[model samples]
Target chain A: MKKINLVLFFLAALVAFVVNAQPPRPAPTPNDTLNSTKVLKDGRVMFSIYAPKASQVTLSGDFLKEYKPIQLVKNDIGVWSYTSDAVTPDVYSYDFVVDGVKTLDPKNVLLKEGENGYSNYFEVSGPESAYASIQNVPHGNLQKVWFFSKVTGKMTRFHVYTPPGYEKMKGKLPVLYLQHGGGDNDASWSTVGRANFIMDNLYAARKAVPMIVVMPMGHPGAGFFMNPGIDEDPYYKQMFDEIMPLVAEKFRALTDRYHTAYAGLSMGGLQAMNMALFSPQRFGYVLPLSTGYFPPQIKLLEEKYADALRNPEINKLKLFWICMGGQKDIAYQNGLNCNALFDKFGIKYEKANYDAGHTFITWRHNLEEFAPKLFK
Target chain B: MKKINLVLFFLAALVAFVVNAQPPRPAPTPNDTLNSTKVLKDGRVMFSIYAPKASQVTLSGDFLKEYKPIQLVKNDIGVWSYTSDAVTPDVYSYDFVVDGVKTLDPKNVLLKEGENGYSNYFEVSGPESAYASIQNVPHGNLQKVWFFSKVTGKMTRFHVYTPPGYEKMKGKLPVLYLQHGGGDNDASWSTVGRANFIMDNLYAARKAVPMIVVMPMGHPGAGFFMNPGIDEDPYYKQMFDEIMPLVAEKFRALTDRYHTAYAGLSMGGLQAMNMALFSPQRFGYVLPLSTGYFPPQIKLLEEKYADALRNPEINKLKLFWICMGGQKDIAYQNGLNCNALFDKFGIKYEKANYDAGHTFITWRHNLEEFAPKLFK
Candidate 1:
């Protein structure tokens, strides 16, 4: 009787924590009642913030073509707001510029972490966004792995996405070294880029292969990207000397050329192209999104890699795909120049235009399209 | 040879992308030039924000008792500023209240994510903080694991911390099911609580047994805690029916009672206490930090578990440690009452006073002290 009662007591205690405790709540203020973002039924997004004493407020976001600041009107209660026109279905980063200062939405907890700062993000939901949206599909695991970097002389962190059923998988899986843009870090691809969700959706639909994606920090710190030239970059050394070996040693990744891929957006895209070109035997697929080499860099590339360009082995890569966010992409001219250089060297490749602009929306679309063609 | 030159070109491209890509920078405004937070040489921290138009600005943080908002002085440049006296070495969360609105520091990127909102945090370095600070020690991996919960009826995510060398370890490790307080989520313990860094430091010093720590979302959504009572709480059902089994299956966790422990803060603390008492044989170590059962709940506990309370096997557990943040803790009275009840029941346990209030600072100290004694 005592044992049975003890069992019942334990079961009750196990479940009781959630029910019993009442934490003290902060004194409610007038500002606490204001909703910061509202997604209307018609697809428009209305953003609001309470700052009665402010003289000026404006909204700055990536949804705008050039990140133009839109003025917000203040109401009688000192609440400033702006309702945007029906936006396309996608996730976009934004911030409020109040009296010349960049400010995050106080009401929105979801943030897009960048290298130097952070901004808030919201999704305009629709069928088009279903690929990257959190759905009913089995989810993957995103791990924040920190390792000491010999190249950087500091602890470097990276996000690794292991697909669903990874823990119980029977064998080693193909690997994709996915990277973010110049200003973003390891967290960008998984959070703002929604890479894991995209992969989860694709895998659930049987449109993409199950793989492990490693998203490493692109730049070491602020202004790290400003130092021109590949030889001068610490990430270059870190990738080959530290990151790759660490991933291979830590994860059950298939490191052979036929099972490996490299891909990135913008600056990351450039890195991807370089890795495939430099170590032609290491990767089966290469996808560079919304990025290309300058004409001078292309000329230097032709002069420097003439032998590798002419080598028949360079053609053995399963895919050398170039993706762009159409003509509005900032790197369109550079991409065209780089493609011309690829053509001049008789390099065979596939290119696609996914969207408009050098942003996550385009990159998400690029991944959605390019991922299905990999590891075949 | 064209092949060799192509290889060199690829190498150049791979390394060059980091060098060559110039992402467009946002036009710098006057607000961009001001530093938001400056940790002084004397340990006093100065915070500044460019908000020329705002009439009033105040700082709200956990460092202050009862979270009193500190008023900031506006200078000629319309910059609002505040200088805090030397703070003891610890991490603290803060936010700027502009006029009537709660705002984030535009200059600080590191944020502590909560269930409903986000706040920025800063660290004051000292010997006391060394244990939780990032040191030159082998780090562990923090993974965001999402799984479908039949109990919650949705996709539930939890943060799992696998200790250093876990991948190469030969045997299954003991598991600590750690939880955060109300209004916090799975990310809080790793971010603000510094649970990973604490474990890393402890492991490096050989003071604690290496183990896996799982921080699950304590509440499903907003106000889920207000529903009151164990039978009605979804998390109670979710914890036993789904989360525990999922962790054991996915992670290399030893499911035996001796290999399991439960700990939590505030509401989570109450839950931990319940788990240990309810299922006395399941967890060898039980820690409830800054929390206790209220008088009414104590009456229920006594009435519901009278037979189990009399059972002697409860005394066989290795450790039942209770921790509090001294008298200033919100739950101090309830903790005292709960202790009296434990004494009346002749339950053996150790208790510690770690700090002065109900916050992460106290919890961090409590974890640092309690972890070394686990799985012994």
Candidate 2:
């Protein structure tokens, strides 16, 4: 009878373990019950955070003008809150500056990693942001691929997005070599730029041709840039020597100039411009966004590619597009100057501009607008 | 000449933009120059945080027993710092509790997403952690796959790892349906569990047969559990109905029972056990780490499959492995009591236990050991 009682108790303990086992979830504090962010029905966003000991709380995000951080008002219960004016429909990244230290919204799990730090991001979803939002359409597979870089002597990672029905597609796909900015990695375009979702929505809408988007690491090292010796840049060396060949072979990408395209933003834009000038016959489309080379690099390009820049093949590209974020963009003047040089060199390019500054907002818009025009 | 000088000044500004362009690289404060986490030469880790305003700072992580957070001492400049004792070479996740609020280390970019929040992770590299670390071996691709689940009626995401050279593999590959615990998503195994790297190293060393690893979302909703009426559970239904068929069709996976395996941890472990019991002929290998069924569920299984449990076919399973953490593990007693019932039903299984409690540390070790014995 004692043994039977012990067995029953053991069984009861087993049931308790089955019901109550886990690594004890992060205990929520008493005052942490409030939602930190709320996108109101009227397109206004409300931000809140609870920090009783903090002297100041402010909201800094891409939606704000000139990188300004707005202040939050604290209530009696130590929860600070802020309500914004009607914001346009778009995805935005933000961080809460608490007592001079930038902190992520503890209530928000969505994050976008930058070169220096990570920021919490949210979407004010509406019709305008429909292309970038996750829809009920067939989604693409984003592959985290690693390739050994002989130049860098490390296993570098990159991202590849195969569009819907790509696995069963009959013919080889055209490839787009997308590059991130100076302060981002390969994952930036897919995560923050919403490249996958954009493609999915575009495919569902029958607005674009299905293609493989390859995002590779642009910066070889901290200070590596496509400057005077652009051909010798480790990033360029790796892309041309290892990455491009791997993409062609492994992904069965179309290798002809008509099917290959190169596009990038900021520093990556500069790289794309260099790749276009260095090998004028390699890419059919070259798009550079929110970036321009310095005068010295432009001078080097003028001297180095004196023949290549003027060649009629350069004009034969399907698209040579250059875009900037209006006059307020940090690179606006620089881009204008670079275009002036291009005009002198008999280069042909289409230029466009948007109102957003040098941020992912402009880049996301750029991708959505340009991806459809590729492999046509 | 004056115009030429003005043009030269413009060139200087362009070069400055080239050199100093980016969303201003998250302006580092004067006091934030210290490295936030440093894995030292002696295998000790030193953590620092530049929180000048916080009153109390503490470190909480899996390495600390029973989830106890250790206090950090503040320096004269208000920087919180602590040096951990010699830690074994493995990956760890941690967070800084600042004034009772959990905060990530701003300087560290490596992050692991938990159910509620994100934690910064660092690695102490050594030969012992060689299987988990990113070695200079030919790595496989981890694809972020999306499938439409009728049960959940959403575009659910899962992770699939194809071994190195899988693109050119001649035949269909075996698959291990891996799952994360209650407090994680599909990405947890690849990121924190280091499942991809473990398989990579194991394949490189010829310790394990090359196989595809499929990790799916375990929790259908917040309070979803694999309790009574487990077959009707949405997670199980979705996995069997939608995800499995999609994998078989798209991945060209081997569908025979001998090449199929199911393994999970914590809540996922319980789900795996339920899956093995409910569909006894589906998986040849069943490995449930740090988990067991409750007594009522066991009684139901015993009553429903009284003849099936003692059938010789159940004994013909290639591997029925159950593992747990040592005495301090929350599920240790529950596992023993459940095994007692298995003995009464004449079930057979291989059990293993490690010293670490119910944490990823133990599960990682469990994977490193059991994965080699799978699909042999």
First chain TM-score in every candidate? 0.89, 0.89
lDDT of each: 0.79, 0.79
Taking the tens digit of each residue's C-alpha lDDT, what string does model 1 give over A35-130? 787888898888898777888998877677663578999999778999988788888777787766667787777788877677778887889788
Off by over 4 Å in 1: A1-30, A221-230, A302-313, B1-30, B221-229, B302-308, B311-313
- Model 2 chain B: lowest-lDDT 10 consecutive positions: B1-10
Per-residue alpha-carbon lDDT of model 2 for A96-212, expressed as tens digits? 877776676777788876566677888888899897998888888999888778888887888899998887778899999999877677888888889999999899999899999
Q: Candidate 2, A197: how far from true, in Å?
A: 1.0
Q: What is the DockQ of the complex in model 1?
A: 0.32
TM-score of each: 0.90, 0.92
Q: Which candidate is the best by DockQ?
A: 2
Model 2 per-residue lDDT at B366: 90
Model 1 over residues B1-376: C-alpha lDDT tens digits?
1111122233345445646764334455557577787778998888888888888888867676654578999998688889988788888877787776667787777787877677788887889789889888999999998877777577779999999988789879999989988767789899988999999999999999999999999986434352214465777778888888989888999989889989998878878877766667778888998888766678877887677666676677799999998887767777898889889999998989976577788999899999999998
